[model samples]
Target: MGAGLPADDRARAIIDLVRGQGYQTIEALAAQFGKTTQTIRRDVNLLCDRGLLRRKHGGVELPPEDENLAYPARQVLNIEAKRRIAELVARNVPDNATLFFGIGTTPEQCALALSDHPGLRVMTNNLNVAMALTRNPSCEITIAGGRLRNLDRDVVAAEARDFFSRFSVDIGIYGVGAVAEDGTLLDFGLDEVEMRRSLAQHCRQRFLVLDHSKFGRDATVRGGHITEATAVFTDRPVPPAIAGQLKEAGIRLVVWSDDATHTASSNGRG
Candidate 1:
């Protein structure tokens, strides 16, 4: 086989193929792309090193759904898409509303977008979020006391759950590690899951924010169901099956594209 494009372009296409179909082989990619076996191996190794994929017995495959990228790695992925979803969610947050925030990159993005929202009280398990929204002095911030996980900069466990119990927030915003194939919302830590559930109970409306990358991704702890959230904001269209499930559950689905929010309901899964 002969090289058809630059190494980076071929590498990207290799990842896309694996992401869509589960896995791909160095031999197969070499044949399809007209590249040598050694060249394909190099591409797979680079992606694996970056935590984008993993080496299976004979082929490279997407990482396990529960296998999270490094916190820093996660923050840089889908950056513009996250900003778009953040804008969509933040636009609906009024100035005087009290809110709850959990941990994860997408929620962090949402907090940043709410910097100018005034007259709000925010109770959060994420210290970074507290600091981000503090840019608006008009908004009071309260952070839960707990042992902080330095990797993700989130406070979790008994104290965090107890602290969230003290307030009835107008909105509870959360990010999932992944949305399961069955439409179940999932995260990684058990304590974080409990804390999120507690926060949800203390809020009047719940908003789940995540990008489309989480679709079909895996995670271990169960946070809640799609029906549990009042609405979900994302950067890509929901697939037909998931859209139907959400619609049947009567949860509003909003997808952002070209700086516009296109809404879909249970009846309009097209």
Candidate 2:
């Protein structure tokens, strides 16, 4: 609700808000931003034209439930939050740990954070993660065999899912396309979801890395839940109900904000 922000910043904020809230009316948006309805309408029109949002009768929602944002846009959106989450996840990793890094920008950022770590073995279907680890001379990277996905720069074919099942790693780091308010994890397609499931099943510890915008967001395919993770890392605290579930499941919640990380296990352990 920072009305002083420039138009582009406001538009991005609007997208995140609508994504978290499902839909927002023009008047509601204007009131939230302390702007006029006419100004909000103009912004909504531009967002609709760009296919980033869908204009309903008197409100805006996400573009399409079946598709995700363009990869480049997703890469830059919530960039700072993703970096902080990634760094904290990396700090928890041991120097010689073996890892399974899954698809998405957040995983790639985690790989980047581990660049200076020694004696690491990484198995990944994400090309970006593999390339990021290549910068570390002491890290060993194994990539899955499949035709690369040009859009996401990762492979999520059936064989890739099978490839993940063959490894029993110390940790699995992954990101989801969206998260339902009830704590269900959603992805764009079955292959991606299956691949993530396989990674979870094979790893000793599962790290779910995501930014706050993913909460209440929509996606086509749903496979896992937040409780499946050993720890959930994000830039903001999750919804109260979901946090309660995490506590019940004894999963660790790691929040990164204001340049500091706060970690607590659901069982009241630090």
Candidate 3:
């Protein structure tokens, strides 16, 4: 429905994702909205000039202390950083692995990065993930059946838990709404969090991917702690206290900065 959705609705969706995720890149926006890069750029320019968004290196982000942007807007945010995280996630998740892509723009980016890998099975509650992974001919995709959340195109309900109960996944990847001050892994909805916990419990490994914007942001649902993730991939240095907590909890932090990779090049946390 997103691909065939009207221009105005598409733009609004972009704004929702951007606001929620904090960033969106021009190219990613174009792909997600099924528009040309030129068209998306025009929209971004208007939004920026109106003081709604600020330009990033290759994307647009919520300006000032904004809490959330459109989903399409977030698809474009921190494009390079998300791509780097996606690449590493794809590389680490072996071919033929069974994966679960939970809600968030970054998980959709991970689906895009996995377009080439063959012999994979993916289950997701996010419509964006299903659309992105449709390019991979060899990958079998399963979508959870549940009530649709119009703004984000995610499926969540009692049936969603049943959907996860049917599969044993090899890798589970998710995007966070924010990292709460008390070291809680936060998100927006209680249903979404419960669905995520269910999906995560079925996987052998779970990784959390988010850009720097999530830190210090406010979100209502306490999903869990960073320790729930086997590894956390971010685009910048984490707050020292958070990093220490991650290290202490035995969660690996992988930062994808422009200058270098704060990776688990060895088994150690960064």
Candidate 4:
């Protein structure tokens, strides 16, 4: 099924397959996908370095449960794809709009994309997002009060959820730790899930911003489903099942990759 895909796309497919089966040997993957072991090795190596997979003896598997890739590494993984997604998401926000920016490097990129917009009021738990929005002198930033998570450089705790619940915003933008094949959103901790749900509940329009790698990824805590979002911005096409769910829910779906030519959107509800 993955044989005819582009190298990058095939890599993504390999991940989905591995995620489904827990682990997959390079030879098995190569045979299943009709690719040579050498090609599969290259794919596995790239995905492993990106923290999307971990190399086993003769196979690859998902990263350790509940623990995500280091924040710094995540910041650079698929960076160009992130920028493209961020830019497209920012374009949809109007000046002076109030927003809830959730934690994650992707949301940080969104903050950077929104820097050029004037008069944005952003409430976030992400220190990085707050710092990035500082570039926009007109943006009013309100940060949550909680013990900062030094590694992720964000706050995702009960206090953070309370802080977000205090204000209703025009738009809520957030990223998830993973997207289960069944369309459920997953995060590393219960606090993170609570905080994100609070962000979405208070917003008039919730934008779920994620990248292709998020699909079929693994995370411990289950949160709200992706269909809850008013709109989703991603760097690649979603799995067919997910795309159908989004369409059925009347949620807008936008696929804007680094390759501008692949950008597309289907209008739905706010």
Better of 1 and 2 by lDDT: 2
Superposed model 2: Cα runs more than 4 Å off: 1-62, 259-270
TM-scores of all predicted structures: 0.78, 0.78, 0.74, 0.77
Tens-digit lDDT track for model 1 on 138-244?
98998989889897898886766788888888899998888877888888878878887887888988898989989888778887877688888898887678888
**Leading candidate by TM-score:** 2
> Tens digit of lDDT per residue, candidate 2, span 161-220?
698888899999999999998999999889989999988999999999999989988898
Single out the weakest 10-residue window by summed lDDT for candidate 1. Answer: 261-270
* Model 3: worst 10 consecutive residues (lDDT sum): 261-270
User: Mind sharing the TM-score for model 3?
Assistant: 0.74
The window of 10 residues in a row where model 4 has the poorest summed lDDT is 257-266
- Give per-candidate clash totals: 2, 0, 23, 0
Against the hidden true structure, what lDDT does model 2 obtain? Answer: 0.88
Q: Residue 168, candidate 1: how far off, in angstroms?
A: 0.5
- Candidate 3 at residue 105, lDDT? 86
The candidate that achieves the highest lDDT relative to the unseen native structure: 4
